[model samples]
Target: MTTIPRISLSGTNYEIGYSHGSSLKAQIARQIEFYYGMFQYSSKLDREGVHSRARDYEATILKLVPNLHQEIVGIAEGAEVDVLDIVALNVRSEIALGEFQDGCTSLSWKVTGEDGKTVQYLAQNWDWVRPVQQNLALVEIQQAEKPTIKMVTEAGIIGKIGYNSASVGVLLNALRAPPTDTTKLPVHVLLRLCLESRTAAEALSQIEKYGAASAQHILLADLSGAQCLELSPIKHHYIYPNSDNFLAHTNHPIENIAIMEPSQFPGSKERLERTYKLVETMSSKNISTKQLREMIFADGENGNFGICAPEDMCKPKWFRTMTLFNIVTCLKDGEPTAEVVFYNGSTDWIDPQNVVTL
Candidate 1:
């Protein structure tokens, strides 16, 4: 009798001082598999449900040739890693959470995989970039349970909206490369991993991941809270939790690093300062997680979007957002239910019941 071999997918789990709870962990693995299948056959995914428009943008990622798998050390499962490496934190810095409470998340940085690392993919999608800037939009992702609306790019992959049973939603933008070594893990996977963590502290634990290569800004929030900060450089990875704020992350050089640490990216620092300013000044009216998405696309006025005066970007501008995304996830009490959302322009939300495959 011959048996098949399974490969291990490496990922880091960070935490302030908590766990993702047992039930949620199991559910996360299942959800990951579901998202993978959906991603692998996204076009069919939307249609299999009810009135689907998957063909609109999801078709791109669904049609994407899985090229990064080549660098991995094992077989594939359309989307590998049927597991989740998570992190948890007890508290965060108010300075960090200040960004979202106000509006906009534009932290930036970079990542570098080690010599013997096995990376899965290296994809960079500037939802605010050219070619597709003409169609900055958002829509609802119809699922069976409830709606987990999202904002998507013309190409998909970039999911920035919707909430699950937890009333928790996030708006993520690529500040830099999301590590694929599995050892260090990808930010998307990590952020999605955070979705599974029950509380803010629980999810922080889900972030303790390996060191590889990557960087970016996460404008995360729930009905109760919101945060925006940079993913610090890998080599000098550190976690700092304080009172007042529950969680706070940034991409610049952390407070305490060895003398030989690398320098922070110039653009990243500027974005951080600007983010602080945006949060401090922006007004809070007609600002739902959905509307803030416009900031990610084309904010005619710099009220929320990353448009206007100093176009903050690395050569790519149009898609750059003060809030270049509109992803939502409907979770109950921070525990993920059957709802998930990914948005771009005016993406609607996805209902929980709809995500289930009959």
Candidate 2:
């Protein structure tokens, strides 16, 4: 089994970034190199154009979230690399999908456990470049006035997926749509904002406020309930749980929104349907965290719709995608705990309790 490194950071935003970059500088360098190759291959763009685009994206990020920009700068300084390289990774998803086309899947639900207690569960399989798995790190960030965050992210990127001490957890899936205004917050930065939120409502408000540059789906869950938002560049659609208190989403937009376009990954529809069916079947019985983890790694008939991506299916020669990691976060006794399975083509999951707190 492969081991994912864990990093702990504290203090102001810059301080946290410096700590994060200094500790993982080598990984950051490799991550940037890998992404540059990806950009070159997928977008067919030359090096000069890629750097120019990264700088433009960096300017947008600075305009929207200046503090995040400071953090990126700190990371570049600490890692002894060009800030544009870090910025490239920060907005890689957008650049990859918009100019190139890339995408992930997530399934979440709130159900009554065997003890008859309402439990919120979220599981995600992050599909991306296989090499990126090496850059993966479990990061815990502590700030003076903001909510402490624990997230699974790439070496230089600020946030991707994770929960906070305030019992707030966020998971995301990529969506495809026509491009819109670039000034809005990118999805990854919005994810960091979600972690900063102390409650589900606050997270929703933050999403509504900044919106997104492209298309993405976010599942925001707290101890009380969970919500899924399908965000296109032009509009946002909100989906609440069904009467059974279950919600699930894949890469595609389920809601009938005008802004949503066809999913780049057609497999997303199958994944979403299979996920919903599995959750519904599991909800009929008493569910446990262990069972939840099993469901994430479940293989469908012939391994078609399984939550875990098969090695052969994850052929880097084609899509440059793989299930880099699987994350399951839950709230127990009003506290957030997370278990992560760093996909190493094996079934090894790590549970670290109390790693994130309010």
Candidate 3:
């Protein structure tokens, strides 16, 4: 029998990363790149103008992994054939990538294939003081042997990776920088590029290196508190032991390394404020995961900000989603089984392995 790469999260010990399926990397990448291309690689967003930011993403990738193009570019090229078709395939629910902030503290998991396995890690959240900015964030550690789960995303590769083995996926809105020759090297090209890896690290490397798009953060977590690094072109890494109980993220580029640059964006502030508000609610003694779900899905109008796109996201033809989530198989042996919820209000979603065991 073939031991395929099935992404199941069971108390941090078990299988993850590349599953036995048809081009897991390409399937993941096509979903993202095609959407960007369909929308012509632009969003109705203001602040953090992305067209110019594309260059920054390219530069950052070059610095992070200079030889990435040779390793994963082929996957990106193959996916291009059906990117447009695939983008049009699914519009029922947009792909989202994230984890419950509270559920993912201090968990570890591993993903194995024909090659050696890689560990996915998580510590408590922290704060960061970058060269020009500062913020609070959670901490996670993992390596990339085409890292199967623990990794950082590149610029312009919006919603970058971590979706190959789980139902959770994230699609980002590119705030590209200016001075771009948008004629040939648009950012949409990179989304397809990112989906070409079996691990989070591999996807991250692909996006960062070949990323021609502009800037956006790409941090995703599975249900077990396993996290990935999302290095934006303009980063502002934060420190740990913050107060987010439920899994959450904003525009802030979080890194504990202290070498990241400062990020400047109104969206980052807004998302941070929103995250703080969530933390407050979760920290309450009475708050439960159900309430946390409500908070995530809460909104003022019928179109709930609860799992909604940013208020400024007005592009009718863009990758619009509320409460984007990605569940990876990054759990180590000591954590709990992974599960997720949708609309930030549903019951926890258990993986198939847990279901079978139950």
Best by lDDT: 2
lDDT of 1 by residue, 61-164 (tens): 12221121221111112223311111101000110121211123332111111222211111111323222233333333333333233333221121323333
lDDT of 2 at 261: 66
RMSD of each: 17.3, 3.0, 13.0
| Candidate 2, number of clashes | 1
Tell me which residue pairs clash in candidate 2: 165-357
Which window of 10 residues has the lowest lDDT sum in candidate 1? 86-95
Q: Is candidate 2 or 3 superior in TM-score?
A: 2
Model 3 lDDT per residue over 1-358, tens place? 1112223211111111111012344444534444344334334312223223333433433454433322223223333433222222221011111110111111122223122433332212111111001110111212234322222222112223333333222333322122222222233334433433544445455555544322333343333333333433333232223333233454434453422323343344454455455555443343322333344433222232322332224423333323322222323333322222211222332223322110
Best by TM-score: 2
What's the CA RMSD of model 2 in angstroms? 3.0
Model 1 superposed RMSD (Cα):
17.3
Deviation from native of the Cα of residue 258 in model 3, angstroms: 14
Candidate 1 vs candidate 2: which has greater lDDT? 2
Q: All candidates' lDDT scores? A: 0.30, 0.75, 0.30
Clashes of each: 103, 1, 65
TM-score of 1: 0.39
lDDT of 2 by residue, 282-351 (tens): 6544676567656644443325334566544544553645566667787645566777766556444334
